[model samples]
Target chain A: MMKSRSRWVYMLLMLLIGAFHILPFYLLFTTSFKPIDDLSSKWVLPETWNPDNFKNAWEQANMGSAFINNLVITAISLVFVVILGALAGYPLARVQTRLNKWVYNLFVSAMVVPPLTILVPLYKLVADLGGMNTYWAVILLHVTFQLPLSIFLFTGFIQTIPRELEEAAMVDGASRLGLFFRIIFPLLKPITATVMILTGIGVWNDYQFSVFFLQSSESQTLTVALSTFFSQYVSNVGWVAAGSLLSALPPIVLFLFLQKYFIRGLASGAVKG
Target chain B: MEVGGVLNREKQTERLAGMVGRNKRLHPSAWLNLLYVPALVLFAVFILYPFFKGIQVSFTNWDGYSQTFSWIGLDNYRRMINDPNIGTVIENTLIYGVCSTVFQNIIGLAYALLLNQSVKGRGIVRTIVYLPVIVSPLIMGYIWYFFFQLQGGALNDVVQLFGNQPVNFLDDPKWNVWIITFVNTYQYVGIAMVIYMAGLQSISKEYYEAAELDGASGRQRFWHITLPLLMPAITVNIVLNLIGGLKLFDVIMALTKGGPGYASQSISTMMFKVYFASQDAGYAAALGNLMFVLISVFSLVALTYLRRREVA
Candidate 1:
């Protein structure tokens, strides 16, 4: 309900916000594409797009092995996070017993426990358990930290499925386990997508936990590898930018394609807080 | 329709809750609750156990390695209090937590409001704003590094256009913390915008129309109708941002490495350096406890305060 003149100001503001948000990425793109010797300002695209930085980054960053580690950790962590979160959510959502309610509160409260607060002991524990630099160790850590949000979301979504769906099946002597597997789990698809995206992104992008726990060269994730690489070669801005760009590509691509789900997942997950 | 949908969801929840009460005894196989055992086991081992262990370690003189370290009684915490950098570290953390929350909410709400209107290309703008949230904060730091790298930074590029001296935005202690907060806000403000947009959308149009009928101006409607109803979203953003910001590590580590002589260290990064660089595990654990206490107290207070003001 604005006049045309005011609408112009409104649109201008929108443009500015858009430009401001994209500026870093734009600068990143130009930097990543430029060669080490190219001394042009970050604003200017190289006269000739050079593949050398990307090639050098791929080699020096140890990206191939790091990619594999990240994939394995993220993939296993996602599976466990989803299954365990969904299972934990079921009775917590449906039963609502005193113990279940307490358990649910435990999961929710765990959300506030910043993982780093326990970093000292967590690292020690994992090290004592001989879990450092192993896939399962980091995987379990990710699953543990991620379960709270997943449980919260799963519980909320399941509660909305009317009780009759289960009760009616139970009257026909459908076993409780049978009921969940046959009737309920399928309906959890939407929330599973949300959980996967939320937790998946988290595990994939995690640096705080991964940097310490996944320390070895063989076990390093993208962030860990890139951090080590970047620090060692801080003078090589083009290489660092390229490595960063390479590391960022998959999530950015996934987000672009699954834009709706990504935004909805973030809003629903956080607003329920 | 919005009211009805919310009411229906609430009623369904209420009815499901009622069923839980009614069927408490009807259902014999309560073993279904055992489904959560696997998850609880992970939590117990990874989270619960380590939490207590962190507290225990805080009281020790462990050097983060070696077989034996003596018990120290509150010595580590006393050291934390006496540590010259502790005050600056804590101050940096609060600035990170509070400043980011404030600016993110303000800017995020503004973006949400603008995009909520009938504008062309707003969809793309919203997508662009949210894109950074998905990228790794470590990567996001490097992306900004190219722009703040002192020698050939983009900020300096723009500075030279104005015939000014090139500035190293990241290296300066005065600007680094604020710049880190800015990057953090930029990365996460999208989430805030989405939450507020959801909050704004859920406010019934009738309230606005009723206020309009009373000749209320835009500002009045926003202050009266919108702000109060949006309190829940505000509470969520504040608590979430506070916690997230307080525990910030990646972006700072990537950008400054808590550098220029611990000048830009938050508690999280500071604790990291203490443990790894200084090999003071006991002090690190104490710092961790302090951070835990800091975050929990801040978020709980904000939650309680905001919850009281919530209209619903």
Candidate 2:
């Protein structure tokens, strides 16, 4: 009897927690469907569900351009972050030298310094190179910010692999590069996948560097684009709601699809390193 | 004695050299060392050089654009001490950091305990909770900005269903800070929960079994067994959340722009406003340096204590 009562309380608690977790999105969705007239008016349900809000938001925000730009930057950043992180991780994991140790420390310290601190100097650098308004500026910053953490993650995972495999490869006359591509690279698939997902999500969601560096309207990513909606249509409740929802959709979808890997990667990336 | 010992060492050295020569023809340890050069160069260019440049720029009175500048030593640091916004922004950041850290841990640990129940759909529930973490905080802020809108927001709509007036969550100064903290707490609770869950799972069930055999209640077992063991995860989560809160920018930028009179601005947001918006790059860099020093000092003190406790 007591145990059953305890179980009931537990269920109630879980239900409450779940509701809180999902409530903001629920609110977002409902507000997105409301008409401008109904948006500020108190109503449990929209008198008429307005699909036009989405249409207006997409066109006014130029989401098509923003989406393509975001996709390109995120995809390219992920490829570079994963490849570079793995390569950096491999040597740091294998080699024992004062220089390697110093390099490792340098990477670790980079993680602690907040990216915003360097935003001004980086901005100046990009502006000097004439890359300020280009996609490469945001892409490069994302890569730079992500590289250290991803390298740390990859290094931790790499350390768990037996050194015997690489030593054996060396005995078999494989070049260091050949041994890495043949053995270490193939073996690093799991960690690489984790790096890709984590870094991909990070790059996909970045706002600061993107907002600062990519000043051109043509190059505006989804984050900057969604923000621009607010600045342009400051008082348009319907358009803001609709634009907000559209901005959130891709990530929500990505999370749902990669739920298993993302959850694992998040925990491993944080706790392991 | 010295001559005999030196001769013996020379013989050993010759033998070692011959062995090394034999392996050197095959093993490219020296060449493998070169693999790190490209990555190191990239790091120096992108990470190291930029950081030093930031430090150098901090000491100067350069606007981001002009070629001419004078070095203003300690003026930026002095201005930060007298800045009116400094106290309020720091206060807001601390409140946000502490509240979010405490609340996230308490709720997260609870979920971890509850999920450990042999319940169905546990995995699905965990995944659902983690969903928001994958989204950008800027986008999350945009969505919630609408949610907290005084009218036509779902929050207000729901409140009206209960016959209460709509609340101005973002515009009101007091509530605005809490609301900002709330959104941060809301988005990150899942991550904290998942991390705690991992920590919880690592604990052996035998302790619980032993406690049950001793006629302990579920609450007692948890306080004794679960809470103590989860400290490492707690320490890690707390540090991460606190630092994250201190450096928080995007959400603050998108949601309130540190408005309602900068009531909800954090250290990071203030830094941005000063540097980019106000064009006080030197003062902003001073602020950034302050945060860097604070974080380094706190981490050294707190993290060391945590590590020692873990070891004990």
Candidate 3:
């Protein structure tokens, strides 16, 4: 252990690091609350703590509709991700057939392919499908891209579950699929949470594909809506700030509540995969 | 962790599947593999198809939206090689990819080490560092945007207090890419820290205890014990950051939009400009392919090189 006198230095450094990390956020806090007329520097807190920025940004940015679109897309994408990712991971993890191995590799390799690399044709494909402004188009894209990591995580997690559970279930005359539903699905909750957290956040905060696919004002998600708002009101720093803050509120709130799961899920799902 | 599972996973799965009764009659379990059909179809339609189509489109003379275009046959690729703006774009991409990786890893490792100590307020500090990572990168960039914007910006205000001119951090070519990298590094270093912390915890305290008994200096113990043992974590972080930073689009779009006239254009952002604004979908597709290769090669090489060191 470090000496008591020097330990204070380390603790001080820790607090300094915390302050350093929180600087942008603190600035965001002040800027978002301030009115556009306030000529104060970003370092200063709002003079009167105007709530108009929030109201204006919310209305101008259509934050309500964007929030709903984000929710619908993220929630639906997550459902497909869990169902397809977990189901695919089961055979890939347990069966280990040559075909299964190839399929698993195929799924995992897609993780490295930056989705933007294919944006040129993907955009055209979506447009051709009449999916240009549709939620399903973006939802499917999110589900597809997110599946690789989800499958990878689910496969890795499933491998660790003991075989005895399945073996015992088999002795009681449970079919493989039946046993999967009965035994394996329940054990998947922990890893599923990790998958959901990791993939759900990725889908929720998505901009790359969404920016391309979800172009209409009616279909825009939070990030898209914020970008549209920022470009339209390029000088409305206050409104932009407010919209940015509002859009980011959901995941930030979620992370705060599930801090343990968030950290652990990232560590296990990403690094291990 | 399961990168090392390759050797044992076979025997384990075999034993498990053997007991589960490997059906000899047409392998009934093979039907189970059909569960992935929907996923495979989605991948083929969305990813696999577009990926190949992008490569095909790169060779054509198609504007982003049109029914008629000639097959230019490598003209777009050739143009990319000679394009005036591309040199800066690629350089910026590297700075985003390679430089951000360096900063994130070094800073993250330091934070991990500091937090690994029995320090007060470590947990809260860890949370603060990681909070930015969950926020959208666009919003994170915008947050920093308020701090660095020239007029009435926080940094400028501090400069004025000191009676100095506020530098244009985001607009200057010299500083634009670096600032973008910095913001990105700020957003993601938490992930690296958390990974490194996990690695550090997994390292046995007995190693440090024995090193202390041997009168090894703290520096020597760290270099000899900690760094080597943390190679796995290092590998994961490098590949992750490299891939992430190379494909960085949102932050650059949010911060400078790859501008003050292409000063900070990365391959990702530049591709967006070419495809949408310039309407040069063919050239954008070519750049897209270049990025694909660049990301694949960099991450693959890093993975291989780091994975080797981990075994050693």
| DockQ of the candidate models in sequence | 0.59, 0.42, 0.60
What is candidate 2's CAPRI-style docking category based on DockQ? Answer: acceptable
Which candidate would rank higher by TM-score, 2 or 3?
A: 3
Point to the candidate with the largest lDDT.
Answer: 1
Write out fnat for all predictions, comma-separated. Answer: 0.82, 0.50, 0.77
> What order do candidates take by DockQ, descending?
3, 1, 2
Leading candidate by DockQ: 3
TM-score computed on alpha carbons, candidate 1: 0.95
- After TM-score superposition, the amount by which residue B11's alpha carbon in candidate 2 deviates from its true location, in angstroms, is 23
lDDT of 3 by residue, A1-273 (tens): 469868988978987899999998889888888887898888888889998999999999998999999999999999999999999898888876677789999998898999999989999999899998898888888999999998899889889999888877666655677678889999999898988998878988989988998888999999999988998987878899889988899899999999999999888765674
lDDT of 3: 0.89
lDDT of 3 by residue, B212-234 (tens): 99999989999999999999999
Per-residue CA lDDT of model 2 for B1-312, tens digit only, reads 695455445434434554242242333233445655655776777767777887888888887778888998888777777988889988887877778888888888878878878666677677767888888898788777777778556567678779998888888887888888888888888889999988888889899899999999978987788778877887788777877776778888877889877788887888888887888777777777777776666555666777666623
The predicted structure with the larger DockQ, 1 or 2, is 1
Candidate 2 segments exceeding 4 Å error: A40-43, B1-30, B157-166, B214-220
> Which ranges in model 1 have alpha carbons more than 4 Å from their true place?
B1-29
Candidate 1, which CAPRI tier? medium
* Model 1 vs truth, CA RMSD: 5.7
Q: State model 2's lDDT.
A: 0.77
Candidate 1 chain A: worst-modelled 10 consecutive residues by lDDT: A169-178
TM-score of chain A of 1: 0.98
Using all chains and alpha carbons, the TM-scores for the candidates as numbered come to 0.95, 0.91, 0.95
